[model samples]
Target: MQCPRCHNLMVEQSFEDLRDDTGSLCFKGWRCITCGEVLDPLILSNRAAHREPMSGRARQKRSFIQIGS
Candidate 1:
């Protein structure tokens, strides 16, 4: 597949640790040789799952305050 960033050919490669958080992270993903862009589906889904949902009422109050000021 072509890279979204550089539009170059993406090569399938295995990596050790992309994030390098705590333990070793081993996953196979597509890598762009031209711009060094990595696309990993697992990481994307993991991030979405780990994302915090915003508080509705608090957010609304903050928005009102900002608008008034």
Candidate 2:
């Protein structure tokens, strides 16, 4: 994904918890490498459901969520 603010290429990266949260999701986030914009993979998964399933991406996304929970 490209950064909305700066039109920079985004990269996938992971981060460990910096602060304690009792019940927060602890997954890593995708961010713009140059502009520092955050992207939510979960939101992408939800949006993918609206499109026609031509590839395995949507199915894979659904399976990932089910496995996560």
Per-model TM-score, in order, reads 0.49, 0.40
Tens digits of per-residue lDDT for model 2, 1-69: 677789989887775454566655567668888968777766568767776666778788999999999
Q: Score residue 44 of candidate 2 by CA lDDT.
A: 69
TM-score, cand. 2: 0.40
Error of 2 at 14 (Å): 1.0
Residue-level lDDT tens digits of model 1 in 1-69: 889889999999987874646777878889999999888878668867886557876898899999999
Clashing pairs in 2: none
Candidate 1 residues lying further than 4 Å off, grouped into runs, are 18-23, 46-69
RMSD in order of candidates: 6.8, 12.0
Q: How accurate locally is residue 25 in candidate 2, as Cα lDDT from 0 to 100? A: 50
